[model samples]
Target: MKEKLIQRYSASERINHWIVAVCFVLLAVSGLAFFYPAFFWLTGIFGTPQLARILHPFIGVVMFLGFFIQFFRYWHHNILNREDVKWMKSVKEVLKGNEVGDIGRYNGGQKGMFWVMTLCLLALIGSGIIAWRPYFAIHFPIPVIRIALLVHSASAVALIASIIVHVYAALWVKGTIRAMVEGVVTHAWAKKHHPKWYREMTSKK
Candidate 1:
């Protein structure tokens, strides 16, 4: 028999997600290159240091907009509840291939990550505008611009770390990547990891 599958992400959602993801990678590489002398070579990703400097902020805007759409669409699902609290408390058990609480559309870790990413993006975009030279930077005092750069750097670091964990979790979970790539998940995978969400999806049919 063919493996049963359930849709997790729609085609539009997958496209939107990839847009943010690709832009994030470009911005992270360019930002790191600008921030650290050791990683300056990373600027080559955008062709030249000057090019990277020019493109990073533009790409950041694009990424922020893309994620903004994602935020509104999924924020409801990520809202922390009693069950999420229970899941967080039993994170050890979750890592041990067991889930705690009635897992919904997202697990506790994923929900936490979503909020972190949301805040980080907000900070990044605000600070980026203040520090963006020849554009918004000219409107700010030098000290204010300096402060914005600091905030932007801090937020970028936090976002990068969050993405690392996000990527690791996606890879570690047996069928998680398929939910994004193929826009579906195996029935068994859903039943094991998110039985509540699985039931909700199936009940409509």
Candidate 2:
């Protein structure tokens, strides 16, 4: 028997999600403005190239901190389990649009994505601190600063790609956007997508 679930995300979670999302958009636009001449026009969106350069790191800091909040909240649920390994083995089926029976709370893909984002956040933050100019960079060695720049740019590119995939997955799955926006998922939607999670949430301890 299917039954509705209570709130899966609180108001704080939604707020944090949006904060990270907005920061991501800002950083993406500004970062791209400097990445290529074609995207140089993007700086106009923020004001000027000088201003975009000034704002990118600050925006990245805010986005990463927001991600940290979400990371702590969901970390426990994202731990890998035997079920996740099994789900990984059947990933091809999942891509083919077949629902692997007994899909767990997050499945392997979501778990992998969570860890990927977490690692990327750490890399971005660490390298960002090293490369930040007119401040910390003055104290750091030139070689260290150069390496930090490389790592920061590489991590940013990888993070952006991961987020694109994440967004695509959210949109690909029907009812997913509503879950993030409204903090609720219908019982049927939950069961069909994450049977193990649905059962666990609804079951008596």
Candidate with the greatest TM-score versus the true structure: 1
After TM-score superposition, the amount by which residue 92's alpha carbon in candidate 1 deviates from its true location, in angstroms, is 0.6
10 residues in a row with least lDDT, candidate 1:
98-107
Q: What is the lDDT of residue 45 in candidate 1?
A: 100
Output the worst ten-in-a-row residue range by lDDT, candidate 2. Answer: 1-10
Off by over 4 Å in 1: none
1-205 per-residue lDDT for model 2 (tens digits): 6756545677889999999999988988887788779989999877878888888889888998899999999999899887788878988888887777676667788889999999988998899888889878898999999899789889889989999999999999888888889998888777888898888888844
Candidate 1's TM-score reads 0.98
- Cα lDDT computed for each candidate against the true fold: 0.95, 0.86
Clashes of each: 0, 0
Q: Distance (Å) between predicted and true CA of 179, model 2? A: 0.6
Candidate 1, backbone clash total: 0
* Candidate 2 clashes between residue pairs 3 or more apart in a chain or in different chains: none
